[model samples]
Target: MKKKIVFYVRNLEFHAISKNLQTIVNSLDKKNFEITIIVGEKKYSDFILDNFSKEIKIKFILNDFLTSFRSKKYKKNFKNKIFLDFIKLFLNLKSIYEIKKNNFDTFIDYQGMYLSDFLKYTSIKNKITVLHENRYIGITNDKKRKKIKKKFKNYNKIIFLAKEQTNDFKLLYPDLKDRFFNIYNCFDINKIKELSMEKFTFDEIKWVDNKNYGLMLSRLENGKDFQTVLNALGELKKIDKLNFNFYFLGEGSLKSFLEKEIKNLNLEDNVFLLGNKTNPYKWIKKSNFVIMTSHSEGLNNVIIESLILEKIVIANKFKYGAEEILQNKYGFLFNNENYLELVNILKKITKENKKSTDYFPEIKKSYSRFSSINILEEFNKIL
Candidate 1:
């Protein structure tokens, strides 16, 4: 008989968790494992359900009352608060109850937030809670810290995406270090190769025929430091006498601010905001190079995707993934907001004819979907 493994998450969308879950589900052996996903009701869930193979089962859960109540406190807008609360109280509660009813062999909580509370309430014994990081324990107030710590204590296995993230967790609860597992987020290497080979249809903006263009695909959040990319672009123009078009993909709160900065810097002609593209990989393939200027990141999916496309990457030396992925050869890294240095590096890479193929084999060998399944299998063994 196949072992039933259920993954609980907020949504089955195109987010980081969903992407990884999709990869893992596709990679797993159907004969040995029966996989089911429990997620909140969202339009993206329909996309996943439609695309997934018949062997894997997909389930929807509604948002809970506590989640809605919390949304009211956090969300400033009154209408949004009301709407979010309704989804939580009705939809989320129903979903949680349904999951509890279908008692699986293994229950994995992908979202480390309120999902833990639901798991704690449920009588599910073989439960594994995966956390990217213990953000609440270290960053929040004493009350919140206690609550998070209590949640951390309840899980059968606590999985971290990176070793550094695991180290951060160990600092908080030294005793639980033994229970902590480091599972590097991985991609389907075969799928990546397949995607790279497939020709993507570019629709809206026309790609510049001759000039090189840089690509940055990320949420326009404050922590992303897109301003740094804009500043670097200005400096590159002045110092290297280089002219390149830049495509900023994805939407965020900083849209207006970034637009204002682009206008102020007189890069209105050069910089183009393509909004959110359903197929960002198409843009990645068309670009001369890719840039990531985040203040911090957990293993970035975009970086890996760019590498698979054989596009050279330039990134700020963030704590988690950029430096880890680049390893000095695949791309260039800037220490700080030194635009002159970035400009010089851009000049060097632009002139080069050959692509860096050094990291490709290693990344394929180590960071594949099969590797992630092996990591999860090891976790299953421990459980």
Candidate 2:
């Protein structure tokens, strides 16, 4: 009999977790396993339905939570934190019940992003939680760490995206080290390369029409450190006599702040915020280069995608994954904190090897080592 498996994620965003989970789903032998994906939000239901429903079933936890008036009204009321939590629990209980009826043998939380979503999966005997960000494990207090460790002990396995992430978590709760497994995020290299082939007219992105550019597909969030990246661009503009517009293509809370900062730095003409493109790979393929300025990350999917498309990349030296991915080849990594160093690296790339496309051979070799085929044995070893 095939084992019934379910993958759960609270966020409905089409992002790394979604892509990585899809990779895992695609790798599973249908003769041996049945798959289902349960997401908490329904707004992006079609995203999974359209791409993945042929092989796996799709379900939602909080059905219509995005369109529900009570949910929306309560979200705006800051003082109703306790009430909001109570209402969410009421809604999630039904979702938990629905999932329980399916009797899945394995339940995998793609990213332990929402604690409530994690709590809802207790009906499944085999619980596997994947923690994507090592740098975001913010529990420093001994008491809280102990409590969290106790919660983690309930799961059969806790997977980290990288070894550095595993080490970071072990520092918080050493006893859980035995239960931890390191599984680097994997992708379909050929699929991404193929998707990058889809043609988009210049009108698809108007700003790039007349500009030499660097592309950054970052969420406008604090962790992305957009300020430091903009500052470095400002510095480069001041020194180097070259014209390059930096295109930022993702959405988050910091969009207005970043826009104002760009204006303040006199970079309104150079830094363009393009707000979450469905096909960022198209821009990645066309840009002069791609960049990552994350203060920290689990493993950036875009970096790998950029490499698969053979784009010259300038990335920040993040705590865990950048070194492992870049590994002094295929791309350049500068100090994310040091503005001057970032500026200098940009200067060197522009002056020395700006329009080069020779990285595909090395990038393909590295990407192959991290592809789903290579990751399959490691993932199954734990089971």
Candidate 3:
């Protein structure tokens, strides 16, 4: 019998978690698993939906009334505590009804956020939640940590993208250590190469046309440490070694801040913010290499995708998943805190103008372990 599985996420935004969920959904064997995706938010990018198989079903938990009630328009109109309480009651009841209506064999929380409040009340035997980031990174509060630990007890299993993440989480909740499982995110290698070859005109190609370029494929928000990257560029310019153009392919809250910083650092000519691209692989393929300076990560998908595309990756030695993914051998690793180190590495890479073919043999040997077939076999064991 096909296992009826439902994956729940807060929203299907153009982010790493959503992309990882998409990859898993597409890679699963349709003959053995019947898939359904439930989203908490009503508003989401259909870009992920466009790529999903037709057989996969999608449902929104929030109805039009609840969606409008949660919107800016309704908040401004309805400020009564009694009305707010009524909305909360309706939502909880609705969620409970939605969950109980389906007798799913497995319930997977794709994102660790507690969007599905009624999940704890569900009696599903195979309850799972996937934590995408380093849980203990910025969280310093003891109360919050205890609250999260209590929440994890509701799940039968917890999926972590890196072994380090699994180990750290185990330390936090020693009694629940047996519930944790480390499963590396898988990639569709051939599909990534095929997408890179897609015929799409990038108008900003002129910026890096004949020059060496490095791509940063991430959201422009906190914890990314983009300032360090810009500072490194500033240092490289001072030494006259800043020959390559740096492009940011994703959008976020920090766009204006980064733009101002770029101007302040006099890196207008060396740095370009290309905003979010639906197909980032094309940009990754065209660039000389990829860069990641995140303070915390759970097996960065961009770094993996860069390697799959045969592009070199330069990242910080993050405590969580950086060394595990890069292995400290495949790509360049610099101190995320030290801009001077980043500057030196930037100088070295630009001066070398290294080709992907040089690392092709090692890259292929290392990345093959993350293939879809291998991941599916492991994933099936859990299901």
lDDT of 1 by residue, 124-171 (tens): 777787765334434657777677778777777887776777787788
- Evaluation by TM-score, superior candidate among 1 and 3: 3
Note the residue pairs that clash in candidate 3: none
Compute each candidate's TM-score over C-alphas. 0.85, 0.90, 0.92
For each candidate, how many residue pairs have backbone atoms clashing (under 3 Å)? 7, 0, 0
Superposed on all Cα atoms, model 3 deviates from the true structure by an RMSD in Å of: 2.6
Q: Rank the candidates by lDDT, best first.
A: 3, 2, 1
Task: Flag regions of model 2 displaced more than 4 Å.
Answer: 45-48, 65-79, 113-123, 135-138, 208-211, 354-361
lDDT of 3: 0.81
Worst 10 residues of 2 by lDDT: 65-74
Error of 2 at 141 (Å): 0.8
> Please, what are the lDDT tens digits per residue for candidate 2 over residues 1-383?
98898777765566677778878788777888899887766646345446764778877766564336333644456567766676567656755666688898887777673443445555777778888775348768878776777668768788888787788777767877888888888777777777777787767757656567898887787778787788898888787745777888988889989889888888877788888777677788878888888878888888888877778877878867888888887788787678888888788777775444464346656577677888887877754
Q: On a 0 to 100 scale, what is the lDDT of residue 135 in model 1?
A: 49
Off by over 4 Å in 1: 45-49, 63-92, 137-142, 202-205, 208-211, 358-383
